[model samples]
Target: MSYELRDHTADVAVEATGDTLAALFAAVADGLTAASAESVPATGGDRFDVEVTAESREALLFDYLDRLIYERDVRLVLPADHRCAVVEPNEAAREGDSADPDAWRLAAGARGVPLDAVAAREIKAVTYSEMALERRGDGWYAYVVFDV
Candidate 1:
């Protein structure tokens, strides 16, 4: 997984690419955490599971990141390491004509330290502007904008 932070007028942006949807999500999550913390260690305090679902890929990403920010603000902690898995409909779903937007979901676990120790900028919220989630060749790529 790889990600880069881009400059935006009053917000911050993150563009990430991965071999799979889950990897891409993980990268973005890492980027979000990095934006709020200088260094996220591989091992830390406690662990928590986060689960989210949305209508589309882009919505799913927005919800996922927003969930992270919510957790940080409420629980006052940051993840040092995380693992995620995204379940999405395949070409097989087209054969069934299922339009259930709730079918797409992501499950993840974050491990880390309390928010008091980390030093970095705070992300206000996730934004839809300049957001993209698409398949590029054999991998997946995404661009997310944050209201910093």
Candidate 2:
């Protein structure tokens, strides 16, 4: 899995690729962290868990990133070292028989340090504008833009 930050017109965009859906999400999460900070320490920080769910995979990604931004703001930390897993929808859910709004779920574990520990940039929000997620040749690729 890997991720890279690209220059957008005025905002910031991230492109990520992974061998699996879970890895794809994790790489994107890592990209978000990198976009939020110029440098983060390798060790000694607080750890946290985030769980987010949505009706669709794209929505799940949006909410997941938004939640991380929320966490950063609320906890005053710069997140890093992300580990993420995606739970696919069950057959019933996919068939629209399940009423759960959280049919698509993402569980993530991450580490973060106080914002003072790094040179931080303020990311206003994650946007659907120009967002793209797709499967390509046995791997997954994602593109996300952030309003800085």
Candidate 2, residue 83: Cα displacement in angstroms equals 0.6
**Candidate 1: segments with Cα more than 4 A from true spot:** 90-102
lDDT of 2 at 102: 49
Name the weakest run of 10 consecutive residues (lDDT summed) in model 2: 92-101
Task: List candidate 2 stretches off by more than 4 Å.
Answer: 91-102
Q: Give the lDDT of residue 34 in candidate 2.
A: 88
lDDT against true structure, model 1: 0.83
- Per-residue lDDT over 104-134 for candidate 2, one digit per residue giving the tens place of the 0 to 100 score: 8778988978888888999999999999999
Clashes, model 2: 0
- Model 2 per-residue lDDT at 120: 91
Q: Who wins the TM-score comparison? A: 2
Q: By lDDT, who's the top model here?
A: 2
